[model samples]
Target: MITVFSLIAGMLLTGMNYLVYRQLIVSFLSKKTGLVCISVITICTVIYISGLRIVELPDFLYKTGAVCLGLSFMLFVITLFYMAGKWLFRQVSLPVNQRKRRFLSLCFKGAIVGAGAGYVSTGIYSGKSLPRISTIPIKIANLQRPLTIAQITDIHLGVFLQKDFLQAIVHLTNEQDPDLVVITGDIIDMPPEAIGDTLDPFGQLKTRYGVFCVPGNHEYYYGVNGILARLAQLGITILGNRTKQIAGINIAGVYDLAALQLQRGPFPNLEAALETRDPALPTVLLAHQPKFIEHVTPDHRIDLMISGHTHAGQIVPFSLLVLLDQPYLHGLYHHDSITRIYVSSGAGFWGPPFRCGAPAEIAVLQLTEEHRSASFLRK
Candidate 1:
């Protein structure tokens, strides 16, 4: 099934590239430069798509292919915007003659294309820096000590990210001196061969209670068993549809939404995971996608749930689509007094790599004893 989809998508992309090449050569660029650009684009696309399928390529080439794919998609969007602008302008009466309108159309397309290219460049060049930390203080009734939990998600490490980026994430996370660190998944993009070295820095992260992770859809895309083994080797615990206890706080995690669809029995089982926990103690759940909350209820005794995977849409109009799909696209939402859900915009990016309104983040959750005056702060 996967192979069939890959083949169909590959053919469709190839056809689109051919059409784009024809349009560029015949209408957009000068004869000589058009040929050159067309050849370059075609070669790049072919090499990239081929690399995505060829398992034997050197790891660096595979990573390069992933980056090129992102660039190609960005370029496609630029073309789309240009086409849309042209169609929109034709509908309105311009305060100019045909010649002037032609010039304006060219200028408008140039501007849009330039803006898209600039965004792609920025996304690519913005090396992983210290992620912005937003700390939310929560007080539980039965917790004896103040506990700080750091949550990060969607560190898609295969391409456009390196050890330096991972190191920066680790440094920023360690600065909080978290008692426990939870990664809500999509930690790596490609297969282990493509990202093994790029993921090494994760091994350096220090957490007193250790790092816990649930698989994201991308992990399944990369081969779940292989990724799990590698994560285990790096000292990260994989909580696949299971629960664990830390300092009296029950931490439970479920597989990605895609996994749940394929393996339905594991999820909607918070009751089973929390069987040993007293009803008075606060429980935290790590779910990869925010939509999973639809299957849960406020009466589940789940105090807080952390999730990522939407990337807050990662782009503008696309984010609107996400809002329609997710109840809590980004930020915290209280489901009655017993259950609260916080959805991270994600610490890393996917697809085109650019993030518009959504910035990467590292969430610090300070769990304290419940007090009358306790409140949540947004930074």
Candidate 2:
């Protein structure tokens, strides 16, 4: 039943995409195609909703459904706003014209609306002080002292982020005065050539144990090696399937899943990287994508694994999709008795400048000891 419902929903979404595409093309083509697209979309939506067992949904899922509906409505409004702006500017070629004036006016209106939508969406999806600090402390037997690590990931420093935002992130991170700072990738959407000036602010970040990073899918899309070199120049240690020691802790980082896939071999051997290190010693894995956890074993003696890739889905309806793809979507999860994983939602947005469901985040993780029980039970 659930599979059937999902199929119907998928079809509806596909039809909606077709309608949106038609709407975009109709602005330059014919109205007949636009009408047909809308008709198909309407029929699909009707069938999809009608076939769903909405009455049987759990309370939490029902609430999620409501949020998804709201998001869809907002997306529809944004699409209309864009279409309206396109139509209003169809004839304007010059910088100074009546149509240009009207287009600017519509942009101002759209901006106001977009801001409100962003605020509302951010509030709804924002979990306070998350990827929450777990009270069940991680015990690293070899560590003589506790380690303070600051993690910032998915800082998609493009379109939406600039100097001011980067400054704020640096300030917030610096406030912690962490022994080590790790960035888990997606630093920018494009190559340094496209955003070198905008990315200058990241060079301001300071950490005592040094800042480290691994490539995200976006970095691969742009140019992984070049991006790594650029970040290296900024004093960030790019850990491409490698390991480094910081304050007696073994920190291992692997390239993104995309990179691993491209290589098409037994690449990023976490076991090989950690082989020289003492199993009793504390180990921190800085994998860019959370999906890496699936291949790991608790017996490997890893203490903490930190990652970011989901962006907590970035928007409503899509968050569910992210969850479906990864066992640990966001926040901390214990795989077995030894290994603990923390998946950050991400520090910035991708594609859309607006961050709907997930707010940008910087995670501060403090390593501590867990209490042991002396009592023994007879089975």
- Against the true structure, whose lDDT is highest? 1
Q: Identify the runs in model 1 with alpha carbons over 4 angstroms from their true place.
A: 11-27, 31-43, 46-56, 95-106, 127-130, 136-146, 189-204, 221-237, 260-269, 315-317, 320-328, 335-337, 351-357, 368-379
Worst 10 residues of 2 by lDDT: 370-379
- Per-residue alpha-carbon lDDT of candidate 2 for residues 1-379, written as tens digits (9 for 90 to 100): 6567666765765555555555543543477876665555445444434334333344344334444444443445455665676676676664678898778766756674676467556645552223222222344556657777788888776544556676777778877777788899887866666666666666877777889888787887667777788878888887776778778788888777886656642246676667666555588888888888887786767778889998887765468778788777776676667777877878776544344556667877767664422221011
Question: What's each prediction's TM-score?
Answer: 0.77, 0.65
lDDT of each: 0.72, 0.66
Cand. 2 TM to true fold: 0.65
Q: lDDT (0-100) at residue 28 of candidate 1?
A: 65
Model 1 alpha-carbon miss at residue 162, Å? 3.9
- Model 2, global lDDT: 0.66
Tell me how far the alpha carbon of residue 373 in candidate 2 is from the true structure, in angstroms, after superposition.
16
In TM-score terms, candidate 1 sits at: 0.77
